[model samples]
Target: MPQAFPIFPLLSYDSRKNSMTEARNWADKKTLGGRGHFDLQSSPASLVLDSVRAGDEGLYRCRVDFKKSPTRNARTNLTVIIPPHAPTILTKEEGQPVWTMVGPYNEGESLTLTCQVDGGKPTPRVVWLMNGEVVDEKSETQGPQRVTNTLTLEKLTRSHLHAALVCQASNNNHSTPVQTIINIEMNCEFYVGFSCLKDNKRGMDKF
Candidate 1:
């Protein structure tokens, strides 16, 4: 009778694991030939790794054994990586954002606030938010380090006074996220409208 090769237990790394130190096992328990499994069968001698992440960098071995047989094995390692998304604002930057009237904008002229974040790997994604909700606009990224995210609110009525604006810079690769916020004044004075009304009233009674 031909003697069967043995199974050997080894270590492996799975980036998706809940804990970094946690190890996983993957090997074909039964082999076609008691002698050993050649590279022919992808199952018994092969493993397919998906979404390989940075944490997956480590060593692994294949453990094999047969009834009343000695143990034999092989070794393989894997590495998984995920790329960066974009950069966004975490909190109010250095300067206090300024707002002003434009083109006789009595209703607190629509102003623009641009935020920039520096440094990230594989670049990052830029997004703008209002009171924790994402603002609807075309988000764009530029340069190697700085990413610019802008928020444009058209015809901001008095309802949006003292609105909270936030900028979120995202790079899914990193464990901790980055973000920024701005307590923007989105309201205009009603006095401007009241003055206009007074002027129109004063000029009336001619026809």
Candidate 2:
């Protein structure tokens, strides 16, 4: 006479119950309706995920039960990394807010600007660059999602006129850094008959 074997359903670890719970009785499509991202099959006994998001990052445990064999369990830790949004440049002139362009500032005047970005799984880092060289970078976390960096150029001179000031932000190396560019404009001076004439330098914005 042959002995009978009882069938068992596949299960998932339930943290609340501290035990295994049946997960759709091993491949019941209707049980997983509305969650199109999950795929559980019998042949390979694997779970697939699609279009993952930051909210899906966490610890997961799967348990498999068999009719005539020992149970199997697996654990996984998922981490989702999201890129940051484009940085924005902001400043003020004479107590008024300014964006993109900061001035027709007089020569030897001080200039200050702030770069800000929001949204990323890991907080983004903001930096300031001038002429392809890093000039200043001071970052602060306003909360879990926002980041800001400020740069100040004290005593702007004729050499700083039309210079490209770049504000860049990035949280990961896999993606290109988001950046904003602004140009520094200053008063230009000319000599005519021993008299110094001053005029505002004007042109297209530099990258």
lDDT tens digits, residue span 1-207, model 2: 532221432223233333334433334334333233333345655566556566556666666557568978667776888988888777744434355666888888898887878887689889999989998878999898899888888988899988989889988888888888888878977666654445547544433
Candidate 2: residue 181 Cα off by (Å): 1.3
Candidate number achieving the greatest lDDT relative to the actual structure: 2
Each candidate's TM vs. the true structure?
Answer: 0.42, 0.67
lDDT, residue 92, candidate 1 = 30
Candidate achieving the largest TM-score: 2
Cα lDDT tens digits, model 1, 142-186, are 776666766666776776666666666656655555765556454
- Model 1 accuracy (lDDT, Cα): 0.52
Candidate 2 regions with alpha-carbon error over 4 angstroms: 1-47, 94-99, 192-207
Span of 10 residues, lowest total lDDT, candidate 1: 31-40
Clash totals in order: 28, 0
lDDT score for candidate 2 against the true structure: 0.71
Evaluate residue 124 in candidate 2 and report its C-alpha lDDT on the 0 to 100 scale: 88
Q: Where does candidate 2 have its weakest 10-residue lDDT segment?
A: 4-13
